[model samples]
Target: MARRTHKGEDDGTTSNNRLELIIEAAARMFDAKGYSATSTQDIANEVGLLKGSIYYYINSKEDLLFRIIEESHEGALRAIATVSHLDVGPLAKSYALVTTHVKVFHDDRVKHSVFFKEFRSLSDNRKEIIRGTGHAYSLFLRSILEEGQQVGQVDKALNPRMATAGIVGMLNSMSFWYQDGGSWGPENIGSQFAEQVVLGLVSEEYLLSSGGRKVLLETIRGELA
Candidate 1:
């Protein structure tokens, strides 16, 4: 039996599936055209539904934007959770973080693009909600760097907060230039980025030490595996 959504629509579409389609369509339109330039009618045209029908899935266009940003943030949190459980050192964990971060952007370019590009378009309340999630993700990265420093793998002198922000900024920038069929695939770009971020943060002594080499190789293998 087809379940009807709260909107009372009986198109034989599940509510979750319908909502996903609406959100995806909105993300695509918002990514290509600026949020301010994108209208409800535009989303409707992309989704092949009437403008009024969109309201059945969301309260307003702003709501759709908020959902997209929230979804991306949720994905980041999930990635952080996955990396946190790995039975590896901070360097390996950091490598996993970078790989996961870049892959998310590559996998969902439109959502992440809308997330990075149109975040400010959300209302104050929605902005606060998204900001909280962003801060949590930031703290997670900072914690990873701090753990690395404590273990003598990362530079003790480096500020974890600043390093975290820098790494995140570098990975997030991919949404601006990364194309679907780019010469460098997501794994290659992610692996190279992991090298840059992980090696840059580790101390010279650690890099030269046997333990450091083992850790580095293990981290690389974990990323490849």
Candidate 2:
């Protein structure tokens, strides 16, 4: 059980700002020192609050963690929602999905990092809630892959369900290894990832058409504006 430090006290901060502070602080603490290792006092101290002040904004640390995970998916889901409205082909649409995910994963990376590492800690009840959101995201990817299969762009033999799992597993695993800075930005990293997955998914005929593949990738992989 998590230790109770003290009773909550009023700090006179506005309700909204104080809550935001707690959420952001908790994400950082979770990122820096795994969730199980982090404490209410750690978050309170980070926010310059009394030990119990955190409880004023949230019932428990796990609730805060759940909130973070939910927010982490919000941006990406919204981005993916936009993909359906695009005029692009399956391959370009695939690139958009991958690139949007890359940018979202990196944009609020701390929350995402905590999301990947700490998701298992959620109670089964809460896990079910989060799993709903996860399923929606997975379905988006699967639909695009299935569309590619229909168009003969993706290999007819490919299994969209299994491929979605593999791709999501690969992308989520990056949370453990990808660093904030290096030669690559989200665009480069996302592009390279898209290139690899798209290549593997391409049908033999599609892969053989050098001009077709080259032209499409160059067009879709540009700034997503």
Candidate 3:
């Protein structure tokens, strides 16, 4: 038999909804005020609950921060998983990764702001877990670059690790300055970033080749479509 929550529905569904509300509230507070400066009362107030009520969903403020960070990374991990399995070349895969990443940040700007700004507030053990996830995401990008190199699509002399770091850094920075109602929306920003990545990293010879140009054009069109 399913356990009933205070709200009278199944425990699982109600609990999940409450947890999401708490996390969303916490994310906004953490993004506006630094993690150390925000209190459980503030989070509870944000969600219209008693201070102690938050304890039902999370043990501590640090736990809330950890959950927010984890949620942000989980979005990226899911995007990577989806793109990794696609039957496309490195350029298309790379474009998809960029667009997906940008969309995630755009969709949850407050959560991602907390993710970037308050991650170091986590305990050592929790920090390690976040680091592991981040490193795996980085390796995914590196693998795509490596594949591009092998196929003569990317610049042979470019360092995959460095390239990955640079691209990731650029994408993550979007959380800082991207406006929700700005003229350039997530898709536009993503496509432009993808174009920059391809144009910057692809071989000069490939860029000049008629066949290579056609392939790149088709890849961008397919992603936009």
Evaluate model 3: give its TM-score. 0.90
Question: Residues 38-111, candidate 1, lDDT per residue (tens digit)?
Answer: 99999887777777777888888898898888888878888889998888888888888898988877777889
Q: What are the lDDT figures for the candidates, one per model?
A: 0.83, 0.83, 0.84
TM-scores across all candidates?
Answer: 0.89, 0.88, 0.90
Clashing residue pairs in candidate 1 are: none
Q: Encode model 2's per-residue lDDT on 1-225: one tens digit a residue.
A: 854444454445466787888899999999899999999999999888887567778898898999999888887678788887888878778877887788888888999898888999999998898888889989988999999999888888989999989888878887888888967788899988888788778788877774566764666565345
Residue 83 Cα positional deviation in candidate 3, in Å, after optimal superposition: 0.8
lDDT of 3 at 188: 95
Most lDDT-accurate candidate: 3
Model 2, position 161: C-alpha lDDT score: 97
> Residue 125, candidate 2: how far off, in angstroms?
0.8
Cα RMSD to native, each candidate?
3.1, 4.6, 3.0
Return the lDDT, model 1, position 193. Answer: 95
